[model samples]
Target: MSDDVTAAADAVRHGEVVVYPTETVYGMGADATNPDAVERVFDTKGRDRDKPLSAGFPSVDAALEYVVTTDLEVAFMRRFLPGPVTVVVERRDALPDVLVAGRDRVGVRVPDHDLACDFFERADTPVTATSANRSGTGSITNPSQLSDDVREAVAVVLDGGTTPGTESTVVDPGRGIIHRRGAMADDIETWLAEHADSEPDA
Candidate 1:
């Protein structure tokens, strides 16, 4: 692992927030199981406490350790994960309520970025997967674009050049709902419709 990844993982383990690159955009990450660390992510971004953050993992199998997924949800994850998509699924108790805003389900992100995956694996814990920007501001594509407040709040910043900048498509496969129409909306919609009958009633 790179020195930066090791340091970032250590910071996360110590309940500090960090900024890292993702396939879609730059993301603010913290240990998802730590309520205080997760709250720091929201505070740093000026995000509403009511809004939930996604749990990031290195792979679908890694995510399975912290979320409860049905066969359909697992299929959906295998199809679109490691891409620009956030799959909403039931959260395991290990994931603190603060990360999900007291909701039963949480968004799961497996970013298709080498640096991000490496960080998650090295961290050996789920990290908050929200954009690295203040709430209501444009998502960050580069570390240079990060605001002073965000940059100062984070303990580490992993600059992976520039990212795609588009946000991930947030989908609830079990409920057949596409909360945010982003990256691959049409394809996700098509998949949802095709497997509508197979999904458990929401």
Candidate 2:
């Protein structure tokens, strides 16, 4: 695990992509600040550039600026972050275009795992994170489920056993933010009910 983490960090530093696990599912990551590396992730996944992706933070505190503003949302974030939830927020000016599809918004999450954050820190910035599988395919739960291309594309593999076998809850609090039904769990809904209106990003 240590060797793989080391190699993953090295690959990210050299503008290579790697897959890392979170409490939810495996996410392919690269140096977010490096446009070329980030573009590769979009290409590899056949993702729509117009569809912005979230950036995983090392901790909730690291994500404060992006989401926390009002006390209700702030408190909500303090409670739910570092867990399996992605909060929508108004994008900051410096955020890259590829991050949120050049939209006025972005998604922020601080995974409840050390290895996930370690990858972010190693990349020297937040990395674009999405399910490790091809777009529209079921997410890979275990390293064994990963394809040969995924394996060969990465410079290192960190087998954290298996991921949570599910995806994170994505919530949009502000106006014009609509999330599909049944995509998130009940707990996430509870949190959203109380803080959605207070979210500054909306």
Candidate 3:
């Protein structure tokens, strides 16, 4: 592993936060299973407690460990993950309740960024996937884009050059809904239509 990843991973394991790149944008992440660390992420962003954070994994299979999914939902995930998509699913209790704000569903992502994935793998923990910016503010696409406040809050900021500058498309495959559109909205919608049988209970 790279020294930067080692440092970032160590920070995460020690319940500290880091600003790291994702395929879509830079993310401010802390260990998802650590309620205090996760809380810090919310505090840093000025995000509401009611607005739960997403969990990021190294791969779709890793995400599935914490997110309950049907075969159809798994198929849906296999189709667009490791890309810019946030797939919300039934929470499996593998993560802290704080991550989902006591909700039974959680948003999860398998970002297609090697450095970010390697960091998560070394940290050996799921990470909160909220963008590295104040809530309701624009995302930071590069380390230089971070505000002074944001920069000062994190233990480390790994610069992986500029990102795509878009947020991940948030979708609930279980509900057959596109909760928020971003990077791959059309692709997600099309997949949902093709797998209408997997729709969640109304």
Which model scores highest in lDDT?
A: 1
- lDDT by residue (108-164, candidate 2, tens digit) is 878888888877766666777777887778898788888787777776667787876
Q: Give lDDT for model 3.
A: 0.88
**What is the C-alpha lDDT profile of model 1 across 153-201, one tens digit per residue?**
9999998999988889999999999999999999999999999998566
Sorted on lDDT, best first, the list reads: 1, 3, 2
Better of 1 and 2 by lDDT: 1
Better of 1 and 3 by lDDT: 1
State the TM-score for model 3: 0.95
Best candidate (score: TM-score): 1
Model 1, residue 28: distance off in Å is 0.2
Clash pairs detected, candidate 2? 174-202
- Cα displacement (angstroms), candidate 1, residue 190, comes to 1.0
- Stretches of candidate 1 above 4 Å error? none
Candidate 2, residue 172: the lDDT equals 63
lDDT of 3 at 132: 95
